[model samples]
Target: MNAPEAVNETDAALLAHAQRLTAQAGRPAPKALTRLAGGRNNQVYRLEADDGPLVLKRYFTDARDSRDRLGAEWSFISHAWSRGIRAVPEPLACDRAEQAGLYSFIEGRKLTAAELTPGHVEAAIEFVLAVNARPRPALAPGSEACFSLAEHIATVERRVARLATLDSEVPHVAEARQLVSAQLQPTWAAVKAGILSGASAEGLALDAAISADQNCLSPSDFGFHNALIDDAGKLTFLDFEYAGRDDPAKLVSDFFCQPEVPVPLAVHEHFIERLTQGLGLDAASVARCRLLLDAYQIKWTCIILNDFLPLGAARRAFADTGAWAERCAAQLAKAEAKLELVGADDTP
Candidate 1:
């Protein structure tokens, strides 16, 4: 679908406002401008100013907490940069009042479904492995807690429960409830068991603990569409709106969730190998991480079935209830296959 039209703001007005903000930061206004890709959620544009080629990202709605969002993004991009991850754009300035920001625009093609071939997956995997190598910095003093898969599960459960109570005749609502009920329990059990058995639980005592320590930051929305690849084949990650502290397994699950890319079992194995090697994780830990990845993938699939897919053509495409159930069943079957392999290898 095409992006919603952005509000008409004149170049002169935007430039003047941008100039004032840049001046405050000891920089100059952009010399030229061009509208970039606009998405359903945000308006992105390119600013060719005296300073250099920069990007302007403007929010279409005020529902978001722009201040905290920008702060989190800035922290993530800066931290990832320091750790030698070349998957982020450089943030130059932010104006929370205007709900806009300026950043260094990397030259590259926006990765599409077709472009995410085997080679692209390998490169993207390496980039993420590098980014997840270090611990995420503490959220800014007053910022919100970083996003979490466990928290997301809780939210989905609540939403699904609410949907169940609503009138049963609502299209896909009943099917959504059935899907969540059938899938959530076993999936969450696998994740919990994996975490408890892994080395990451030695110090953490929480019932739903995914990691003993939250050391890595994950782009909660990591996908091919959010990646930009340059001529040199280097990938740069963008869209930090959902960036937050998370377990590495969740990040891997996010990558595998891309509908266009069929991530084979070998891809998963290679990803874990690279990740653990890069992060210096032990073999046992990697095994446990594999199980957790499977669990997270199931949970993520349930989320898509319940929320985004229920209201649109996704429902018809998958067939109302039976097809949706089959999809979840298929995911669980694949997950079980992977888990079986993990279990077999872990056997003494």
Candidate 2:
């Protein structure tokens, strides 16, 4: 299928713009241009440069604040490169004024649902392990991860409370409110207990803890979909919009939650093993990381239900709020089981 039309600007116009920008930088005009197929947050295009190929990312400028995220993306990709993490595309240049940037286009096959096989799972785990091995890069003086566990939990609690108050107006609001209220308190309690008990201390000791890493560089979003496999079958990761110093456990948690795979307990164990091997983490530290991962997953699920599910845009999906609640409950139960297993292990 032909790529979607460039939404913000016509292709001819964007091509002309790219030509001007490249010429200004003393580079030749691109040979070909085509829109890329992922991401709802940014406009991406593949530009075939004279030397080879480069990916052009134009930041959404409709909102004043939306344009500001480019700087963070630049900081992340550059820092990751310095630390030898290949999880990010090689950023070439960023023009904040133009609200656009360029990076090397990794040549690989985009991962689809069918590709989420056992072999692919092993590959994905290895890639994440390599990323986690590196120390998280320090955030710029005042920069922070988008959210923290404490803050996130508070937001969920507040939203759930608001839903409770709106129950009479919305049809399923009461059910969602109850579903959220029932779990909010215990989930928050578990998070607090985990934090106070130092269950998440090892990889989360920095200022932002898992939210922001001190020396470790993390991709803002790491999932099977964002990863690609080259002809050689090696994994090449892309997308750095959410890349920053985050809790290693959070990264693992996001991976486990990816829709592309069914996260069985064995898969989690394999991830820990490969991650430790790739990142040079000790066994004890890996076990500790696993606990933090379970905690982070539960925290994320709560955010999805209490926040996203209640929003007008997402309410339709919760038409059967009872069903949604059951699924969330099931996932939580699994997470709890994993937590118990990892928490009881004496290795870490």
Sequence-dependent TM-score of model 2: 0.62
For every model shown, the clashing-pair count is: 5, 12
Residues 1-348 of candidate 2 have per-residue lDDT tens digits of 114344434468778777766665556778677776554456677877778766778765443233255776788677757768675688777777887887777777766765667787776666555555544445542222323444433443454454444323334445545554675545656665765456355544323322132224456456766777777877767666666655454566566654333344456766766666566554334544555554545444443443233243243332222344455445444433433332333232
Question: In model 2, which range of ten residues has the least summed lDDT?
Answer: 206-215
Give lDDT: candidate 1, residue 165: 43
**Residue pairs with backbone overlap in model 1:** 30-49, 31-49, 31-50, 87-237, 135-215
Can you write out model 1's per-residue Cα lDDT over 1-348, one digit (the tens) per residue?
Answer: 112234344668877766665666566677655565424245676766675667777643333224355656666777777787656887777887777777777888766654556787777677766666645466442222223434534543443354334334434455445544665455555655665565354433333444445335666666776777778888777877667666566566666654433354446677767777676654434544564554445444544443333332333332222344455545444433433332233221
Residue 324, candidate 2: alpha-carbon lDDT: 44
TM-score of 1: 0.64
lDDT of 1 at 298: 48
